[model samples]
Target: MTAPLARDTARERSRRRAARRNLRSALLFLSPWIIGFSVFTAWPLLYSAYLSLTDYDVIRDPRFVGLDNYAQLAQDPKVLQSLGNTAFYTLVQIPLYIVVTLALALLLNRAGQRAGLFRTLFFLPKMTPPVAVGILFLLLFNGQNGLVNGALRTVGITGPSWTTDPAWIKPGLILMSLWTVGSSVLILLAALQNVPTELYESARLDGAGFWRQSWSVTLPLISPALFFIVVVNTIAGLQTFDEAYTAFFGAGNTTYSNDAALFYVIYLFQQAFEFLHMGYASAMAWVLFALILVVTGIQLLVSRRLVYYEGGQR
Candidate 1:
């Protein structure tokens, strides 16, 4: 071969070698996540989709039934009731939690240096395990002698049976959730700090009241964080199984009080593990995914109008 031709061939070989090395490095970095996804998440999701199309109690071999589970879901009054309860809780808790947490952030933001300590105090609840939080709230809201009712009785206000009464159980859960406003507060606090000090100063110079300043300056700037917290908190509240599970143990048992806290996921768990209806649970899971996706899509579309982008659309 000529010397020039030999050099070109060597260069081509070098380029191919470099490309192969890059490909290997990329795969090496991705291997852990790829394995995890395949084993833990992907297989289960795909299998559940398959299961949703079948009739599989854990004991039996899965039977191929087309859409009966879904059709049954339509006629299932318990499913509808659980969905309604979850929706109601989401509607109430999402707004209340957002408003309260944002207000706390605003209060802390005004504090400046002391804000860190106050932030820590508020965020201590976030450090807690949800299971512990549930148990703690359970004790706090116990009917016969609870902290809330005890304090109320001292001042001549009688506290109702929070855990026992079906009418009052969900509200009690909402109240318990108020203690864990820490995550939202942190998100809000970050947004509050990012708001240009100039904006607030200018509003003050313009003789704008606190409300006016918040309306014109703070709210617009913090809208992104507000939207994020709203979305996350709504989803969290909707899938509120942990708290309800710990609070309303033995719900289907004979001794159980009014069936007040039969949350959707808890019911799903009961149907799947407790009742051994895997197919039914899989169908329930798909319906939930659809509901959440629909709600989220609507919110995303609506947020274009409601959530003000700081410098206006990017």
Candidate 2:
């Protein structure tokens, strides 16, 4: 071979060897995350899918049962009831959550540096444990002698029995859920800070007041953040468990209506740990996963029109 041709061939071989070495190094660096995901996330997901098709009680070997568990779920009235309760909680709570958080964000944005202490104080509530929050809910919303009713009585207004009455139970839960909107408030506050000040100035020049500028300028700019919060909260609201379970289903609690507060995850928990229906709970989990996918898809479709991006791309 000619000298120039031999040199070109050698350079090509060296580049190929370097490429292989770089690929190996990259894989080595990523090995930990890859192994963790395989063990913790991917394997569990696949195993759950397999378990969903069987009759396993965490005691004996799983026996193949085909679609029997799903068929039973279809016939279960509690499924519908729990789903309805969860839907109601999500639908009612999300709007109120958005409004309250946005309002707080607006107030904080206006407060400027003076709001530093208030912002920290607002976030402190979110640091409280879920079980403690549930207990606090019972105390604050108690029917006969709670602080809420006491304040209502001072105004000559009768307060409903929040803990006992079925009608008030869900409302009380919703109110309790609102008590931890600190993270959402912080998210919105950050979004508000990112809104271009020039847009507000232009709105003002066009004779727009605070409300008009907010509606036209602020909301559209921060819509992506709002969409994120809505999606996240919707997923969380559907999986409602810890607080409601602590409030109504924990030991020494037989007063609240199960129909009012039996969220989907709580029912799934009952089936798995309480009843040892491991296979059934696995099916329930997959159903929830499917529902979340559908709901999130719908939200994404709706967000195409609602959520505005600065670069005009969703």
Candidate 3:
């Protein structure tokens, strides 16, 4: 009995040693990613949360102010205006993007092998730098001599002052967003191509026309991609800043950035850097994070009823 017990103990020890060795090797391989996450992602998130509760400028140590920053956000008219601007942009741009991209995808999908050139042409705009795109848009939408206005003039019509007018600013931004729909077009095109051809054949046999088949068959089958594009564009629209900023706040421009162009992220950037309201900016960041989470959750819930999966499970 003692001999057997000694043998069993030896085997257990060997197993424990091998487990520790494997763990060490695994951790060694994972160390770079683990360290990067801790240093860049996790630490910043934790520090930002802490900073949100305190008043801090680069010049001084953080002083605790509890929830005062958050409370002040409630009374900030600029915050409300920015939020409304972001909401409007998100609501308008997302649907229009979906419609336009989906239409493009459907058109390309029907083009079969001949669509390669068109796809490349469409994707080129997305590869353009945002600042460059903003500059181009500024030139095109110039009130007088811009190409858009020139074309309108050729047609004996007038174009609005897209950059300077508050009413047209959001629409200009929406048009800019539309230009980057190449990614969505590619995604939806892939989904459309993956759709079973037998379904369309059956619809044809049932005497369904183009619109009817598209409604009952194509839309239902591609709903997942549609849902994905909607969520992504909504998030992007809420965080819109670069194009509007580059256009309205570019160098040598004396015109102040009006409320129409003051998106949420841009406002937060102003609070943090321009005004040196670090704590308030951190609070705003947290609020934006929470808003994104809530909006995404709501989308997920709504998608359960609307989106269709091939496997029939949401």
Top lDDT hit:
2
Q: Per-residue lDDT tens digits of candidate 1, residues 1-314? A: 69999999999999999999999999999999999999999999999999999999988799999999999999999999889889988999998888899889989888998888888899898888877887787689888898999999999999998988888888999989999898789888999998888987898999999999999988988888999988888778778898778656644434436367877888898899988899999999999999889899998998998899856972
Number of colliding residue pairs in each model? 0, 0, 0
Shift of residue 24 alpha carbon in model 2, Å: 2.3
Segments of candidate 2 deviating more than 4 angstroms: none
- The Cα local distance difference test for each model comes to 0.87, 0.93, 0.90
lDDT of 2: 0.93
Overall local distance difference test of candidate 1:
0.87
lDDT of 3 by residue, 172-289 (tens): 8897778888989999999999989999999999999999999999999999989998998888888888888788766645563467888989899988988898999999999999
Of candidates 3 and 1, the better by lDDT: 3
Question: Which window of ten consecutive residues has the lowest lDDT sum in model 1?
Answer: 250-259
**What TM-score should be assigned to candidate 3?**
0.94
lDDT by residue for model 2 (1-314), tens: 69999999999999999999999999999999999999999999999999999999999999999999999999999999999999999999999999999999999999999989989988999999999988898899889999999999999999998888888888889988988999999999999999989998899889999889988999899999999999999999999998889989988577776568889999999999999999999999999999999999999999998989988776
- The regions of model 3 sitting more than 4 angstroms off are 1-16
Clashing pairs in 1: none
